[model samples]
Target: MASEPESDAFHEAVPLAELEAEGRALVAVEGVPVALFHHEGEIRAVNNRCPHMGFPLTEGSVDEGVLTCHWHHARFELSCGDTFDPWADDVDTYPTEVREGVVHVNPTPRRSDPPAVHWRERLDDGLEQNLRLVLAKSAVALQDVGVDPAETVETGVLFGTRYREGGWSSGLTILVALANRLDDLDDEDRKRALYQGLTEVTSDCADQPPKFDQEEFAARDVPFERLESWFRENVEVRDADGAERTLRTAVAAGATPEQLTGMLVAAATDHRYLDTGHTFDYVNKATEALDLIGWDHEAAADVLASLVRGLASADRAEERSSWRQPVDLAAMCDETFDRLDDLVAEGEGKEWKRPDGFTDRLHAADPEEVFDALEGAIEDGATVEQLARAVAYAAGRRVALFATNNEFSDWNTVHHTFTFANAVHRAAQRTETTELYRGVFDAAVNVYLDRFLNTPPAPEPSPDPDADPDEELEGLLTCFETQGRVNRAGAHAAHYLDGGGDPERLKAELGSALVREDTGFHTFQAYEAACRQFDLREDAAERRDLLVAAARYLSAHYPTRREREGTFSIAARLLDGERVHGADAGSDAEVATGDD
Candidate 1:
């Protein structure tokens, strides 16, 4: 047989009318394979390259008005080549027309260029060169066609090739030419067109260059100030790439702190860019810009506060788990706090004077209270540990008040109480206080007694359960175990208990010790625990009288009221449980369980 003719390799076009109802034809046009489909009474042709990963559309199947790429099973609208997957770039669309019962492709080759190179591309000569050429051709075409400025910008953006393999200089040159065109029009229209074009270009330039030289670029009659002002006034209200460009432009132009602050506030409030990571950088830059401008102390403080609040809000809403592991909230907070603290410290001691009662209002509004009031708002969300940390930070300043009397002595007491209070608060909120507190208390008591008081000699074998405490207590509890000596041990035991103790016999030992030394707080805590464990309500009034007497005896010695209050508070809670007077009523149930 004669060799087949090379011409036979070319695919013959199917007559438009001859297309089977459910058939597709793969044809070669201009040496490129094209897929043809006849469905829903129309002839559709698409380039064989799949929009996603360039899979061949020819090997794909058409069913129910959609084409599925065989390689990746990506579906597209046969008529428009619009990929159904939003993440997939759209496919090339070719105009198909039927003539004389034959489907004809325009053969001129319809090509879709890449997205436009955003204005930031102007910073790179090679890239800018390609971008300029693309823009130049687009502008000339758009002008010849009499397109509106907005439409012109949009059309060029959609059809322009963003970054050519070599560079984007062509697109930048086109943009510069477009910018020059602005000078020929009347002032108002020219400014408007420039603003519109800048907006469009910047909006498309999501990944901006790290830096730009504003003065040099502005010398080219770009009306950089006018464009920036327009952006600040209008575009900055949204966090689109366009808005980012405007802000960056303003920064480049040396915008004032107030101006930058205003832009940031607008961007933050818009909620459009809130989810985008761009806002963080903007806030940080704006903060630095404010410092450079020598903003009024109050204004700077306010701006810093706003940034912190915005960051906090974002942190809460963000899916931190999906974010990079070990998110460092403390590091971020520390940095922010340092900045604000420095500003405050250097402000000539000029306190941030707000309207009367403003500080008071903020101080009075505890987040815990807000959380309680809006309990339903949380749904089942875990406790906001950051919020708790913020509260602790605010409360830290007040801790000094408890240390005024006897610095070291008071500090130790207050510090210990502070830790206990925080633990109790956390436990109560979690509704695990009873068990957690008891466990912690028991473990602490055991550790302290074993390690501090009852520690065995080194290398001795472990003692049997049947070992007698009489041997350990022999000398310590001899006749010298008078009321005073016994009272001393009782006081020590009370110290351990208040720190988180659970020894049952510690109270009797403490009482006897206190009878000798008369350590008032020790007697108080010991008697309190004893009353609770042994149901000493019958002697409750008598014990209270005795505690008063002991308080009087120690009045001339150790720091009295301050130390007594914590001990007494803990004692009251232990003794009366829910019936305790003046102890945190809300904590009564937890205290009743004797956990903490």
Candidate 2:
């Protein structure tokens, strides 16, 4: 019986004789139920409830100085009440004393620090150890206490740059981008972004040595025009070092991110979306990240440097003859904007209009018709806001239906296009960037034009309003995980939601199914885009529409062929032939005799 003091707070829990008779006794002291155990002539007291699932510890079995919860079999040391399993946190133990052959417990248990404080300490530990789950838990807990996500991001950014010798990477780029978009997000999203950034930075820096700082570019006085040209020329020539030097030189000369934004955007768009839209998207995201980080000139330089890598390896779709000839796409795009300017001026006093069937036309996947419908809506007093929504919806359709091979890394294709459209939509919420919306719309038209590549076209979605969503969800998960039914998964989700299924539950399940395994970059982008789309859940019909589109896009390029043609068949024949020949003495002779 270990006791601190026989203060007035101590209350008689049970008679020592009764505890010994039953081996354990549950007693209420100051409204707190405590379980007193009599083992080896010693009295020990702990909380009556198991911390893991609230199972009564009084029913737990004590053996070899350990108390085991029968509910989940979680074990704890009775003496100190330390949980053997990490999932079950340590139980609270009360100081007990056998005074006058009676068990007395200090009903008032020792108070632990606040949850936020505890989680913050855990966050520090997680960062130190680069532990993923701990970092994730800490981020969620910190956000629950209304802590700013920027703080967590700063921690990760500092840790990553300090530890990772490779300078900047895609993870860092994305983390920076997420940080830039953090303030605009809801609490859950902010926390998730923080967790993602922390995890990425930690993972990227883990086991890597610190990088030596680069020698400062001495040509700080170089003209901005010349530096800009040098950066583009270096990126064009795949001179990564030269490109980085140019960016660093420009930054060293006191170039603000706004001042340098034009150069990066120019380099990106100068070559018609350097990598099937991904280059432009990356530039945009990196710019957004720079804006969010707020005045870290070194990080700006690092971001631009990493972007040059993408610029170098990116397959420029602009260079392709398919994009250039017959259409004069630039002229058409300019003409649409010119008309848009005229319409905006004409509809100054008129209320913003939404023509019926506008969404249907977009979902029909006819680019020319979509443009026609859009132009009509503009003529009918549609505002820039309306156009933005229309274009965003169109973009979601592309995300739902875009498909391509792994060789070309079509995932990025889908992601870049979706993100580009999404960015345009977000921009629309604040300003009237009509030209940007047109650009997004024009790029989306190209996505529609490339639909033939989606061999074994996506199956049409049947809107079963009276179906069992839970049953559909089961199949959706199975197909998504095992059979690569990406599009079908979206369709199933739509069906599940239409059948009165819980949106959050389905979203969670969809998220789990999509990311249950190790996924590629495109998968992550697509899912993130999906989450953004789902978050705008005003209408269930629109949600179903978006999901159906996603399913179609995902399913279009199924029965994927990552290997060369006949590779598996040739290997199988060789393996089978060798095994048969080894087992049968004259298998080749029998084949030859049969042929004769």
Candidate 3:
């Protein structure tokens, strides 16, 4: 707000004799719209515009001490402009005094405290009422006051556990998982992660009161094997209490993160890509994030505990043909891992070359051809870096190839695969790349699992490759932000080629877009992997092929429900509050309802 001027501090409006009792008047004092009300033997003034909407408050009905905006029926106290409805923010009140018969109003309202304090209050109101806008403001403003982002995370976690029914969910899982990764990220990314964590939890718990779950851990000294059995049984039965107790018991008994991870993965894999692979991915990522932040088993106990419900909620894959069919995919994955080991050994003395066709073979997607290419690349002396890149791209392809026409909850199918592959790719950075091959093999299994989804694969690039590179690149980016459809991306590629845009430039553009549109941890990992591959400045054609794979993968899996009018609207509104963006429409789905 601008400072009050020395001159014309108070502007006189209508006289008291001319004003009618129990009436509202709209008057402009020093160019500020003020709603003056003659009610209950005194005069009160507030901003003319309703806080809920831009509707004029002068047109609203006033009774006793309350003023109601007719537009949304949001009520505010007459003098203070404090709203009764949480969604509707408080309207600014102006100081007013009547000297004799003349009405005077101060255009510049008095400020009693800093914005941080006010925003904090608004945040509390938001949390209490589940107002997303206020939630966003408070989260952002809290940091401005030197408040730690972790506090926000803790706040969100408490809110989620205390309010949401059915206990933990993917939403809460996302929150807890991101909380573990906060320290490893840059300042900006940390803020985003924190904001995402808080918003996800609030969104998850919104509209639902907490359902208390009884805690029941085994009291007897149980063997590790017995406890694992008991834990799996409890998880299978959706017994959150028993599972939590079993997990805590293991942690307390000096269980390694690896052991806990093994147990979770066992429960997860027992379901054959549980929840379209999200359960295992969440389990894996949460565990990995703990490792990245140097958090021990004690810290990770809660992380896994939060996921018990999500794991229990999943429909197990043991009954599917993917597991029980003539060709056992799970066993095949084991064999592939074995082959990967032998191939890594075989490539020891061989000179390395970039496997340009690796992604192509994965896309061409004859299971045998792709498998052979994986082994052949190793024989041709593919470096750990090259192999890791190819495997991660292949993982992304699994996500892209997923059918989008399924039920809303099924969208996690693609999301889990992509994010899981991303998690593996990132984890490979710190650990030896050889171990991450299991991730490659797992991604391959998912590719095989989802083969039925992509009845028709992604279309190849245009034969006549001649187009304006700049314009085509722009079109492609526009399509990513707007439509995010496969056909549109293909068309843009064709136009770019038709206009003489080379594969190299197109890849660079795609990489830049991936970096810009990085939605979360997995997206960031994909972009980072691309940067590392390209930072070497080798393999132009290989880079182009990889970019094409990315384009195809993105095409297959874009315009996602994740970016729909739901949660994005809250984010958008927050940005709008900063005057940096515009408002968006609300979503039919609740916040954190199947939101990744």
Candidate 4:
């Protein structure tokens, strides 16, 4: 076999005599250690470090052109550095030539794919195999080559939506959520966010089978209204296949993005607070993911398909005791929904003015009054986004006013309502549909249902507190080191905003606080929602309040035992080319050899 071509610039490695005497010799080319081997009448140079765990490969045994790592028993071909085990990954290979009795090796590895292409393939492999380390490496590698991180988000969104048979998982939601925040994050956190989202995507697709896609209608003349009607009807009957085909049919009919979103919005709200408002949230996020990456109709269909399954079978909150007992929020919503079209029409072009005491009525105990109040807002010309924002603020109050006496599990109830409301508000921005109005109401009612959580509302932090912003921020982070101080945490975030401190710094700090913890799905949701709501508001008070709510929520759940954090830390250190295994942790991965 002929040797593959390599870069002409070769570094003098070691004398061929020395390499031949020991059968192999490890030499540094620039800063990297390359192992030169004489085997089967050929001299081969490969990266000395095992790609899997960074173990030195020079000590491993080679036979019949195969180099096997003694640690993991992973075998690779010496000539091309292709691994026999997929989990081990391929090692790097360098072209070598004998020059004046010395072995000269090209430091650059001869690869079939460029860095971007190889890392992309590795990313797919990582996703397929649920390998976080490989995913991390790929993230760093791709970014190093100036490839936009959003591309990875796109890759994950497609993979997750296509592979998860049960429909859109929370992993997809996290991916979309983090994608929205990527631009605001710094480099390291950007990578952290990417790793977190992609890792969740990998976990979600693990062992899950791909969905069978439904093609567009053979005839493309079906009207949008008819297809939408067919879609909702099938969804109501829990016929996923029929609903999917109808959805695809609508897409094929050249339905606008708004029309497609309207279809999901209507179906998702058909039941009272479906899946506790998560159904609409996922629909909105799926749409947002499409927004982040330019919508390809086929890709859009795959993303939406995940949501169609959820809409078809999501749990209706009407079935839950809390929504029905004492006060039937479901009935109120039904009455309000019946008149939604007229209300939306009655308010059209009205130039919305926020009614005095509007939010107060929303937070009040009576569901009927709340519906009436929201109806009045629509009637008074409040836009879809306007209504959604007010509703989201109410949800934020649920967390901001959360009573510490409640069980830790109860925190999720407020968290869920707030995140859902924020997601609905985001959807409203994409399309102005009467259906999303139901989501706004659903969120308000959820906040109402959670009223008991704020029975004795934690006092709202005084705006413009007479305190140093720097001290407050430092103190807030310190609380994360200790046990529950949720109320105090909220105050600090408020003070930071009130004191006119750097809003970017506060966001960055809160973001760091979020990722450092061993967290769950809800935490990511809460952080993203708070940041989102903060950005949407122009009022200084509202923005501060949102971050206050976020700080409290994060503090309530901070300081986890961090079992996974250890593994992530190790992977990060390894990526930085640091030794993490033992006393030689300060040094890079290398094999011991006598000085040449």
Best candidate, lDDT = 4
- Candidates ranked by TM-score, best first? 4, 3, 2, 1
Overall lDDT per candidate, in order of appearance? 0.35, 0.61, 0.60, 0.83
Candidate of highest TM-score: 4
Compared with the true structure, model 4 gives a TM-score of 0.94
In model 4, the runs with Cα more than 4 Å from the true position are 1-8, 99-101, 561-568, 585-596
Q: Which stretches of candidate 1 lie over 4 Å from their true place?
A: 1-22, 97-103, 108-255, 258-282, 286-596
Better of 2 and 3 by lDDT: 2
Clashes in candidate 1: how many? 40
Q: Per-residue lDDT for 398 in model 3?
A: 48
Q: 1 or 2: which has the higher TM-score?
A: 2
Clash tally, candidates in order = 40, 4, 11, 0
Per-residue lDDT tens digits for candidate 4, residues 1-596, read 23466547788888888888889988877777788899987899998878877777887999999999888898999899999987788999988889999999887778757779888998999898998878877777778788898899999999998888898988989888877887668887777778788888889999989877877678788778889899999999999889998888777677888898889888987888788777888988889988877666468778888888889889988888887888777887888888989998998789887777877898888777888888989998988899998999989978888999988899999988998898888888878877888888888888888889999888988776577889999989987877888888998888877777888788888887766566788888998999888887798877887888888988988889865455556666666666555455343424333332
Give Cα distance to truth, residue 102, candidate 2, Å. 24
Give the residue spans of candidate 2 off by over 4 A: 1-150, 157-169, 172-197, 203-270, 283-315, 325-388, 399-412, 430-438, 453-457, 469-475, 478-481, 485-488, 512-516, 536-540, 549-596
How close is every model to the real structure, measured as TM-score? 0.24, 0.54, 0.65, 0.94
Q: Give one digit per residue, the lDDT tens place, for model 3 in 1-596.
A: 44544445777877877666437677776546688898888788887766554456777888989999887799999878888888888887877777777888887765465766676677667776766556655665676677776666656655565566655555555665655545445544455555555566667777786655444354646677787788889888887778878887877776665566657655654445566555655665556545543446234566557667778888655457766576666666566665777888888888876554556676554566666776677777776456656666665554444444544344345445655555444444444535456555565556555565555644545545546678777878777766546556756765675666765566555544432332444443333333334343354444443444456445544444443223334443433331121152322111112222
Cα lDDT tens digits for candidate 1, 1-596: 12322433333466875665446765656544466788877777786656444445666888888888776578898777777863333555555666567666543334443223322222122123323222322333334344445444433332222322211222322232234234335433332333333333433343543222112123334354464455444433332334434444555555555455544443342222132222333253334323333344322332332232233234221234322234432233233333532332344334232233321222332322322321211122213221222222222222212212232333223222222222222322333211222212211211111221112111211223343444323433442333233233223322333333333343343233332231333222222222322232233322322222222222222332333233223333322223333344433223323335
Runs in model 3 with CA error above 4 Å?
1-14, 20-22, 29-31, 107-113, 120-158, 165-203, 206-239, 246-271, 284-303, 333-389, 398-416, 427-439, 451-456, 462-469, 477-485, 491-596
State, as a TM-score between 0 and 1, how close model 2 is to the true structure: 0.54
- Tell me the lDDT of candidate 4: 0.83
